[model samples]
Target: MLEASLKTQMQSYMERISQPIEITANLDSGAKSQELRELLQEIAAMSDRITLVEGSDDAQRKPSFTIARTGTDISVTFAGIPMGHEFTSLVLALLQVGGHPIKLDEAVIEQIRNLDGDYNFETYFSLSCQNCPDVVQALNVMSIINPRIRHVAIDGALYQSEVDERQIMSVPTIYLNGEKFGQGRSSVEEILAQLDSGAGARKAEALNAKEPFDVLIVGGGPAGAAAAVYAARKGIRTGVVAERFGGQVLDTMAIENFISVKETEGPRFAAALEEHVKAYDVDIMNVQRATKLVTGGNLVEVQLESGATLKGKTVILATGARWREINVPGEQEYRNAGVAYCPHCDGPLFKGKRVAVIGGGNSGVEAAIDLAGVVAHVTLIEFGDELRADAVLQRKLRSLPNVDIIVSAQTTEIHGDGKKVNGLSYTDRKSGESRKVELEGVFIQIGLVPNTEWLKDTVSLTRYGEIEVDAKGQTSIPGVFAAGDVTTVPYKQIIIACGDGAKAALGAFDHLIRSSVDMPAEAETATA
Candidate 1:
């Protein structure tokens, strides 16, 4: 008799709890409420997959529940509020609950699963940083690979509670097990090391070991050096990195105009800027490349090509575009000897010597004009019948005394005497004529190719492979930013690239500041 009574009471409770209640927006009334009621009725009748729950005192509050079956296990949860980055997290959570093993090497998994102690990681970041997406994705991937790794993305603007509690002043601030790790940018290897070493306690000493900088520019071109000067004058950390410490500017032969500096050589100008930046104690990393970006909850990660990773709150991507090659024979063998790309860098080296400028576009014509001023003679070769450059440029080229236009001509081979270029072979499309021109140098001004392939899966790109950025240089993915010739912006110039780099850096700073203030109070209040 007792069992029967208990069963009856359970049945009654289920009936009352399962009854669907009406849902109305706070502002909804009369017709709107009726429409919502109809919608709910239709939804309830469509499938038995969901169970409707009614709140105790709110007749207008109804939350739907879905019972999901994976293999032999079943789980239940509310179906609303799953979207955006949260949706990605939800899917991952579901997969984990469904017993789907994370796709990671056994060694990595074992190492992560063995972590039995509590860990707290914080990454600081701003939304305007173009390089942050790479770090964020890497962190998310690591988190998904290890269940014991509880990762949280705190907005520097929205999460004041956590920021205040952690005393975070930068975006991408990461803490492991309630202790502070290094800040700024980092890499996966660096992050793993920090977690394994119990919150980068050793790194704290190393951080103080280095001299304080006002601005540290990673590249030494116009962009990097300019940013360094600006930040240094403004009293910020300043530094720079480049292969030869001058970036692409060192390769140029001459600079006709660069604000106040008139008729200067590329290497000389770049050297001057390098000296200026170095005079202010700006750190420099010549011949270095940033290989990876890593982030924890609030800490940014940067990995170098040499396998070193650094931590910083803000980063500026001044990695300029590389010159595209013609891929003709003997081209690589005599790059600096006879074949060249930047006329402004190599033109003066061929003074009073025969030189050929390939292509018919603006760059090619401009290069031809510049070369005519120094070289004994300039041959402008174009594959098309007519020049593709502006009429003004064509007129200038035609009026030059030492310039010769060779239309319907294509370079077949670059002939060199093993050590340097002696001449080149070409084919005439009009008469099917093959000819060789003795020249001291060949300047290739076809165009430029941006280095954006690394960002393909992370952000949207245009047909030309440039990163698509909005007016403020924000990429499609939040926290990732891009600028300069790599973006869809018009004009690829030194001044423009420098301006873009500054904008990106400032944007990253803004995002970090905003996120620090916008985090949930509960998360902020939680003790380390």
Candidate 2:
């Protein structure tokens, strides 16, 4: 059931107050059904537009209540009530059935329309999974225009049987036409590309032909986008090669630290980055990852994981970083259930609930502080006897009465109530004593693992595996530059990465000019 404010928003969003489709509610004698009936009744009473029909007691459907468009049989069937994030999915589905535009890209919609075969998508997600909403929304949006496409988002907590049968160990695991499609947080563009091309569980499609560029960016995060934009302004033939544009930024929840803009979410900012890059004449090779970099000769060849090679005079590396994992038992099994990494992304789900922070470093302390404002209490556990965070941060964290710090603590396991995490266990590193803390969530903020393993031996890398970049973002190899979290940057903030990307692009442009390859007179003079 939706809150009053959200219902009002949905009502206003509807184009007209008319019953575009009839709803058949099949109720059972169960208590769950009774509650659902009341909720449905409230929705039906919203306007004369919602016409509801209750099925007979002897209804063939086994579920207590099943709601679907009368004749089409297209439904948002919530056997177990669609609570939490699924509730929003249900509301949006109802709007789409009433002919509300999904507001997707035109080209994507057209591709969906041209789909030759019927597609059934089953998405399994935990209620606490922040990334689940977008994946669920994408398939649901497709089902709106293409009646042949059907989707059902199942809460992993309620359907443990299905979870085991499918071997689902992660949230947002999508099954298309009864076959595994994709997992993790995927973009609408990536999903659309897969759908149109009928790709299986493999990576994105390869380039049709090998192409050359004046400068090639290997990753397409904010840094890559900035680099591309800057290089394109120089009228150079710039191309971006990435598995998916937006990189790790897509995993963040809300970005308050980004300068200038008051606030923005990960997906919105990622989309804006892509849109901004597209505005220039940059060749966007989407859904591709560069596996190998060849910087031996004058021409730099980038071999993609998709088996396509891209040649460029200079290359910019912007492959971003990923969060390190806890690797504890049940940690992977209940990742989205209550074990979350980005506090900004999934913190709100634990509102007024106790949660634990695994690391006592700056990142872990920061996550605890962020969660303290939204959650009821925070327990910060560190293996070291002393916290590794800045003294100022430590003071700020201690000021919060609801926050508790545990020194010399090592997390042993994440305990869940079958579906969702409800507690955690740890060991006292100093005393060798074990303890348990009952909580609804656990946030892991160990450190970031840069996405630079593929660049091994191609260019210089730090002992920490981050690319060794100078002030200008140049790597050890001439004409091969690196930026963002993958570089030896002091901090991994988005704004800092963007500035580094711009600098790397400029450095590449300067290399192009110094080499005297079709360089503009003004550019060569400026470099001199």
Query: What are the per-residue Cα lDDT tens digits for candidate 2 across 60-114?
Result: 3324343355466555544455666566766776776765567766866887777
TM-score of each: 0.49, 0.74
Worst 10 residues of 1 by lDDT: 18-27
TM-score, prediction 1: 0.49
Cα lDDT tens digits for candidate 1, 1-528: 124554454334323222222221221344533443443444333334323333343432222222233232223232222222233333343343334455544755666656666554545443322223323443554654554454444443333455546544333455666676665335454456556764344333443354423223445577666666654544445455443555555545557766666677554577587778777645665435666555443444445655445555445545667777788898887775678776653454466789999999988998898789878999999989999999999999999998889999989999987777889899999999999999878888887887655445556788888878776566675554556776787888766776776666555445544665243334333231
**lDDT for each candidate structure:** 0.57, 0.78
Q: Candidate 2 has which clashing residue pairs, if any?
A: 242-288, 243-288
- Residue 209, candidate 1: Cα error in Å is 8.4
Runs with alpha carbons beyond 4 Å of true place in candidate 1: 1-218, 226-240, 244-246, 252-282, 294-298, 342-353, 370-376, 388-393, 400-402, 427-440, 452-463, 517-528
Q: Report lDDT (Cα) of residue 122, candidate 1.
A: 44
